[model samples]
Structures are given as C-alpha cells and as structure tokens.
Target: MSLEAEIRRLRELDWRELDIKEAGVWPWSLQLICCLLLFLGIFLGMHWYLVSPAKQELQRMREQEVELVREFRSKSLRAANLDTVRGQMEELEARMEALQEMLPTGAEVPSLIDSISEAAIDNQLSIDFIRLRSPSSQEHFIERPFDLQVRGDYHRLASFVADVASLSRIVTLHDFTLEPGSGGVRDLRLSLLARTYSYRHDGGGT
Candidate 1:
C-alpha cells in the first residue's frame, strides 16, 4: 500500500474496534510500535536482574586484588631489609653487654667495698664506717646501697670521691652531709649513701 494511504487508514480506522483476537489484522505501524516496546522491556529486565550483579561482583574482586598487592609489596620490602635490621639488633646487644660489664655482679660486692675503703685511705681520709645495706630490687637490676662516713680535709675528701667515681665498676653517691670534725676547722666529717647495681639474671630478686 502507498504510504499516504496507510497513514489515512490508521488515522481513520481505530475507535474501540481493536482487540487481541484481531491482532493479526492490526495496522503495520501499530504492530511495529508494540514490538519495539516489548524488546526495550526485555533488555531493561535482563540488565537489572543479571548484568548489574555480575558487574558489582567484578568490581569487588578488583578492589580486593589491589589490597592484596599492597600487602605483598610491604612484606617484600621488609624481607629486602632483613640483613640491615639484624645488624642493628646485634649492635644494640653489644652495647648492652658493655653496659652490663660496668655493673658489678653479686659476688663482686665485697671487693667493690674494699676498693672504696682503699680509695679513702689512699687519699689520707679516716674511715669512720662502711656499712652495707640490704640490696633493693628493681625492675631489671638490683640496687646495692651502702652508708659511708669519713673524716678528712676538703681536698682529701674530694680526691676520695673522684677516685671512687673513676673505678671500673659503676658507683653512684648520694645524700652527702659534711659537718665540722672534732679535730679542727680543716677536718670535716662526711656522711654519704653509695649505690651500685647488678643485672638481674634470674627472675627472682636477690
């Protein structure tokens, strides 16, 4: 049929006359429009039910892969620096050993006290008393405190203190009190607390 004739038929034909039983005889324009609408609905339904979920799952996996790659890189970097880290740890251990040597052991306390007495005598200081107190327990070491009282001139007392400090073993002096001695103004009596530390090898406090 001519295009003009078809258009005229469509414009003049329909009023409430079209029905499903007469679908085969429907005008071509109407039938084509219905087919296009049905195809569009099917395409939209398939995209919503099937394609959309699959796309979401694919995106999630890609994100997970990125995180795994980042973790792998971090571990690889650590492995590459392993030797340097070990060297640093060994150096720290050597330093700790050196420090531990300066601290006297439990067996060496008596000798350390004798050394202090000798230092006082060497500097011409009269030793009034040298009393060892009970060792105090610390977190990582034991503190061995002692009380020392002596009578001497100012220069001699200073020399004795310097000698004690210069010993190979570590000794810290505290609570110093100096008063006039019985002899004269030049003679002074000094009282002080001396502390030494030893490493705690065992878990129990000594």
Candidate 2:
C-alpha cells in the first residue's frame, strides 16, 4: 500500500472494537510506532540512571587532577630551593653563635671588668674606679653599665679607649666627660660609661 493509504487505514481503525488478546493481529504501522516510542523511553531512562552520573564523576575526577598538578608544582619549587634554605640556616646559626660569644651571660661580668682594668694599666692610665651599676633589663637582653674614672695624658687615654673597643668581649663606651688637670699638663680626668649586653633567655636559659 501507499503511505497515504496506510495513514487513511490507521484513521479508520476502530480502537473501541480492538481486541487486547489479539494484539498480534494489529496493523504493522501501529506496531512500528509503539516500538519506536518504547525505544526512545528506554534510551532516556538509561541516560538518567547510568550515563548522567558517570559523566558527573568524570568531571569531578578531572577537577581533582588539576588540583594535584598544582600541588606538585608548588612542592617542586620548594624542593629546588632546599639547598639554599639549608645554607642560609647554617649561616644564621653561625652568626648567633658569634653574637652569643660577644655577649657573655651572668657571673662573667667581674672578669670582664678586670679585663678593662688591665687594658687601662697596659695603656699607662690610672684607674680610680670600675664601679658596676645595677643591670637594666630589656625585652631580649640585659644591659650592664660600668662607671670608669681614669686620669692620664691625652694619647694614653685615646689608646686605652681603642684597646677597650677591640676586646674579645663586646663593650661600648658612651657619655664621656673630660676634666683637664691644672698647670700646662695634658693630664685628662676622664669619666665614662661602658655598657655590655647579654642575651635574655627563656626559663633560666644561658
């Protein structure tokens, strides 16, 4: 039959008189239409039940892979600088040790004061006083001040100051007042302050 004849026959068919038990006797066009509809339903159902979730999971995995790659790059940069970081740490440790040596802790103050007296005597200066004042505390160190009174010629006083500055221990001189002795003599009565610092430790540290 022609396509127009098949459509005319489908329109003339009496669905009210169709027998459910005799579905095998239905028109071939009607059967083809039902099969196509069923196939489309199954395809949509399969996509919703299976393919959709699989696609979502694949997308999530791709995002996670991107994050992993970024982390790998960051760690690689840090690994490349590991030797340089270690060298900087070693240099800092050496500097800390040297600074600690320069600033001795408690009970070593007297020996340091004695060293100053020896320096003055070696430079031909007379030491009248080497009085240690009360120590002043700071956030990270302690400052111990000493009042030094000496009398000598100009050259010897200068020499003594230079020697004190070059000591193995760290000492800084400040607040100097000079008085000239009487009668054409170059004797200088020098009074000055010397300060030494020590590192402050946490919990009775050295």
Which candidate has the highest lDDT of all? Answer: 1
Q: Local distance difference test, per candidate?
A: 0.94, 0.89
- Residues 81-124 of candidate 2 have per-residue lDDT tens digits of 99999999999999998988899677888889989999999988
Cα-based lDDT at residue 181, candidate 1: 98
Cα lDDT over the full model 2? 0.89
- Give TM-scores for every candidate, taking all chains together and pairing residue i with residue i: 0.73, 0.61
Q: How do the residues 1-206 of candidate 1 rate in per-residue lDDT, one tens digit apiece? A: 88888789889986598897887888887788779998999999999999999999999999999999999999999999999999999999999999899999999999999999999999999999999999999889999999999999999999999999999999999999999999998999999999999999885667
Return the clash pairs for model 1, or none. Answer: none
Off by over 4 Å in 2: 1-75, 203-206
Q: What is the lDDT of candidate 1?
A: 0.94
Q: In model 1, state the lDDT of residue 59.
A: 97
Tell me the deviation in Å of residue 175 in model 1. 2.9
lDDT of 2 at 64: 100
RMSD of candidate 1 to true structure, Å: 3.9
- Which regions of candidate 1 deviate over 4 angstroms? 1-42
